[model samples]
Target: MLTNVATVIWDGLNPFEFGAACEAFGLDRSNDGHENIPVPAFAVCSPTPGAVRTSMGFSIEAPHDLGRVAEADLIVIPAMGHTTPETLPDGVAEVLWAGYDRGARLLTLCSGAFALGAAGLLDGHECTTHWMYTDKLQRLHPEAKVIPEVLYVDAGQIVTSAGTAAGLDASLHIWRQEYGAAVAAQIARRMVVPPLRDGGQAQFIDRAVVEPDTETFGSLLEWIVENLHEELDVPTLARRSLMSPRTFARRFRAETGATPHAWITGQRVLRAEQLLERSDRSVEWIAAETGFGNAATLRHHFTRVRGLSPQAYRKRFAC
Candidate 1:
């Protein structure tokens, strides 16, 4: 139901995610497997339409004025490369607040969530931002529940993503909601990122949480990674730690923000990635060593989770 979309441009913007927002909705993709679809028009609206210096020291022009949001369906506030949300230009917050009041969906990429928070739209809502800014975001917006461990958070009308690359994930997710899974998947294929990540952003963080007293979990996580080729299940892991399965499951989720099975799957996928990129291992042997049982199993999960085969990943990363 998006008729028009807009992105707020300002100084020090991260061009990658800002440009990604435009590419996701601005570019005409009708010829790219989307039939009878009118490409959503995108415009860069700023407090003033002129050249603004980016954090990279390069300048780009914003051609439209911020008042254009009145006719827009969605508005994107892109993260600044070297700026904090508190440094937003005067009147920018008022413009964004007006847009939100007019029923426009407020969206942000990475640290862009701060702009939304400043606008008071993220209050009492679940949102996410780049993992590096997780602590800062939570501290800045105490009213908002910052779900730092996820790729993105979709609060119906409002959506936010973590980090720069994760903006693609948020964009595709929006496409999925507006269109369908098939369209989202197709767009992801066109862009060449995983259509969907299997686990949350937590899976990408350091799995071993630091505990003052209980160091068993950290040792167990290390053991699990080293023994990826072995059959290490929850029951077996719990037995090794001398804790009951139920106790282990609860503690693990609290510590890792994911279940035992999900954690293992992520580690296995990561292992496969390492082998693919760093070694000259065949998919069959890689699967066996990465604990996927066989090449077919490896292919199934790798392609499903990563949206790229092991060979393709190697080809891309090995270079």
Candidate 2:
């Protein structure tokens, strides 16, 4: 349902992230031989609608000023290198605050999340930035829940992406939600990128670390993912890990940052999402397949977690 789209960019912006947003939303691909590609109106706005230098020593012009944000259905903020408290652009925060208040979704690419943090929009939202900047974002916006290594966090009205490539992931995610899986897939094909990558996919914060299963819960998490359809109660998992239930609960939270039940429910919801995307199976069957026991329970949990019912999700994502 996105109509008017705009990017509020700043000086020293990273071109790749800005380009990622542009490629996803700004470009007119009607001539790309794809049918039913919904294109939204696009613009680039800035504090000053003039020459803006990029981090790579080049400049791009912003054709519109901050006033244009008031008409946008979605606003993008691409990375401006490493932004701190002092470097927030003049009058940017006020416009973003106004935009969010008016129900326009705000999306931040990479360290552009710092701009949202500056605007106080990230307060109490589970947002993220480039992994290298996660700690700093949390420190600066202490009220924000900054997760370090996820591709992006979609906080309903605000979506924040991590790292460089994660911006593309976020962009495609928005497409999938607003359009449908099929349309987003066609767009991805046009762009020669993967069709879809769920936002929960991990960001490559650093090279993988090899650690013992006892410390990292690496083996346990793998097993949990594989056996999501089975009864994954705490006692059963505790026995599998050769620890008391209390110790297992503490360890599970320490390693995964979610309680055992919550993590398992999240995994089940992901499994449900995959099933919804690939098949026309009945919700009752999918619920049992994903260990939700019945359609009503599945509906309850899926609606709570995904903000849509199983049927609605299938309508949006099923091919």
What's the lDDT for all of these models? Answer: 0.78, 0.84
Model 2 quality (TM-score) = 0.73
Model 2, C-alpha of 132: deviation from truth (Å):
0.5
Candidate 1 residue lDDT tens string, 1-319: 7668999988878878888897778877778766634577788888878997777879888998888877788888888643445687777888788887878887888888988887677889999998878888888789999998888888867899987777888888777556544556667777888666545677556744333233648898888989999998889998998999999888877666578888888779877876776689799999999899998999999887666787777776552
**Stretches of model 2 off by over 4 angstroms after superposition:** 198-203, 208-281, 285-305, 314-319
| Deviation of model 1 at 267, angstroms | 18
TM-score (all chains, Cα) for each model:
0.65, 0.73
Error of 2 at 306 (Å): 2.9
Q: Give the lowest summed-lDDT range of ten residues in model 1.
A: 207-216
* Model 2 error, position 207 (Å): 1.6
